[model samples]
Target: MTHDSTGLRRLLLVVADGVRHDVLADEMDAGRTPALAALRARGSFHAVTSSFPSGTGPAYVPFLMGRHPARVGLPGLRWYDRARSLSWAPAQARSYAGIDIWHVDGDVHADVPTLLDLARPSLAGMSMLGRGAKHGRIGRSVAWMLRAAPSHFRGDLLGWRRVEQQATGAFLSRFAAVRPKVSVLAITSPDKFAHAYGSDSAPVRAAIGDLDAAVAQAQAIAVRDGWRDALHVWVVGDHGHAPVSQHDDLHGWLEAEGLRVLAHPRLHVRDPDVALMVGGNAMAHLYLSPGERTRRWWPTHAARWGATLDALLARPSVDLVATASSATTVEVRHATRGAAVVQRRESPTGPRWSYLTTTGDPLELGDSLHDLDAGTAWEATSATPYPDALVQLSWLATAPRAGDLIVSASPDWDLRARFEPVSHVSTHGALLRPQMLVPLLVDLPVTRPPHRTADVVPSALDLLGISCTTDFDGRSFLRGTPVSAAG
Candidate 1:
């Protein structure tokens, strides 16, 4: 039953969950991290956009699958699964062994093969998809951690951080002997610390320092194992965190507006009333009841839905609201940016979309409709209130599982329902630029700079000399030649 080792030529992807690009950059500039500074000097760095909703689970999709999480109907932090007739809360898993939020087999259920699948005999730490570390080891580690630090095991941030480092380090140490083709270590400290304390808090800053050392530790191990030059290390963040001034009672506001929120699970299949499935702290995904889902009723319902959306947008805390305008188009109404419509169209270069400003600030800064230029159109799509705003919003609009309407909170606010508590002082999962933009660091010059989390794996694959036949949502940016207008 023994398998051959892949030697040391492998990709080591280090996911620093919820670490802000600015925080790390500031620390690196201050000469606090020689390791990161060394990597930056030898490599390239990019401030790429994270996934829409900017939640860890959705953000992980791009890093792991090189595609939008919407393609797989991955509703952020928490959501109700219509297919399963059940609700899920991914970010707040009750046990150390995070539950299968999808409640389905990863390989069979996923839309595309994860990066873990592409590179076999891989080692993953604290990942829900693909093949993570063996259960026996993880279980034993969890048990040992609980017994050793009983008070700190469950909710204590410092305790959890130490245990996570131990578990990941142990796993990596064991896997080093086997030398898998790919290895991923998800450092959850910055994320946990930022959530418990504000992203800019002293504790979070100290945790960032610790994370820098962890990255150095990984690099040192790779070097000692004879994979220093052979190993391609990527120190990246899943999503950036933003400070929140208030947690808006989005559900409460809806109820005050006379909308009945069906928050509980139904015993039978028949629909009762309106449903509000608010997961991902800074966002809300609204779903219709079973009875109201009929096509015949949709035409009339759309108007009512539009009214509701308008009301939500009118709120001071609400940032943006998007709903399907058509099969290939969506209308986004921002609190300050006003309303705009984006339509998917084909150009000579490739598939692109255009925007038209109807009212207020165009959410997007530039005039994309100038001469109807295709390049301009593409560029306009990129220059937005948030990175890749048009495409990400479009995908979410078209996703069948994405609520009938998706709403985001302003930078200073979070969308909190009765069930989903807002404990974090700083949080992601919003359309704001702070949450969406994450740093991408690599040791080689990327011919075409990456723009989103999805682009990471493709760039790595190109470095590994692996040819991908499937049309990935993310294109490789590691080519030697200069990128064309299309890229």
Candidate 2:
């Protein structure tokens, strides 16, 4: 790590995965989470939008690497490489949903650096993406079993109570063991509860309550170690969750459409013409065969897709069907809504985005065309049903490893409708507000709000008095930091 002249004693980054901003806010307001509430009172709290495909592994990228997953060719939970060699093409499909989680470190773009890489001699706990942590490790055998274990067996073996308690204990031990200048701890219970029980259920509330206790324990440890004042702690959520009452087997639906589908555990489904990789059970990547998907996305999918688009759109709960029409453009379609295109143009300052709708707005962004930069685009759409869709979708469609067609489910619906032994009550991964909005907690007094989770890394670096050796999409939102510090 390249440190600035003045450095802090240490830094602690705590990630409570899948904890919703609204849930946190309500808990904090009601005084159930005293530790985080205290931190917010002394610092700043922002309900920021996380990047698209807001699942576990990929969403963590912003906090650790200060960049969107797409920036590193990681489009979250599932995706495949179109450029893979023929021999490796059949093996190119990637899924972080299970035991394959161990491959995350190797899958990202080679040039990108994780937080552990920049901050060496560090330790990571309760995490799957601890690529650079010196002492990080995972039990592959246990993970593999968990992937196929029955719900009842999993319930008895890995209950939320034990998982969270162990997580807190692990955080304390790892922090003491390494005394790292920078580190991270990801709690698994919040996300777990949301999946097992609905997000609005009592169990979910109790999970956040347990998180509050964990935060308290961390603070107590810091103070007891006489490093409270010297420690810069950040408690944040990677992504939020929404209540899911239903499911749709998009993979099976594709197969029923007379198209072959490639999915995990079923990789031998020979000559697969379409790869249906679902993430967070709410969004899916429909990778098409050469004639349909192609290298350059169809210039006008509305014309090229013919009745296929209509058939896909006609599916129940099918919210949005989007494809990259060009390098700088994204064509969006809906069953009953309408059509629109997101285009990027080089501005004098930098790249600018425009929302062009030929008919009814697919995203319902507006009726007329509008052009805006990243900030303004965020401002205009942050509170909409599809938060920050213009900025997020434009970059997502153009991401080097993105799927041919991005499909999002309607409210209360998720894509992974079959194969799972247990059904999820609540989930994420779509561009909806519940999935995109996450609570951010930082101890520093910010000069401005860093509306994106990607800003967490840069902000932490700024507080640690270190200079990032690489450029990042996320910049420090803290006060007294210069623009060039991110690099």
Q: lDDT of each prediction vs. the true structure? A: 0.65, 0.75
Per-residue lDDT tens digits for candidate 2, residues 1-487, read 1223456547778887888888888888998888888878767788998988888888888888888888777886878767772232345777776656667777776688888887766777666577788755322236533532343335532454564465557667767666677777777667877787876567777777766776677667777886666666687788889888888887777778788888764777767777778888788887767323336565554464556667878888678888887888888888877888889887786667888887778887766556687778888888789888887888787786777788888888898877653568888999888888998987656888778988888877667666877877676787585433322
RMSD of 2: 4.0
Candidate 2's TM-score: 0.89
How do all models score by TM-score?
Answer: 0.84, 0.89
RMSD of candidates 1 onward, in order = 5.5, 4.0
Number of clashes found in candidate 1: 0
| Residue 383 in candidate 1, Cα distance off native in Å | 5.2
Query: Model 1, 1-487: lDDT tens per residue?
Result: 1111344356778787888888888888889877777777767777888888788766787887787777765656555455543334322111111343234224223446777777756777654443433322331344644533542435577777677767766766755666666767777677877876887777777777766776687777866876665666777788888887688886677668765665432223234345565544787777655343322222345755767767788887788887776666777887667778767765575556666777754466554352333234335555565767777777776675666677878877887734422266787788778888888877656776677788777876766556776556676777663322111
Once fitted onto the true fold, the runs of candidate 2 whose alpha carbons sit more than 4 angstroms away are: 1-5, 85-90, 137-161, 290-294, 300-305, 481-487
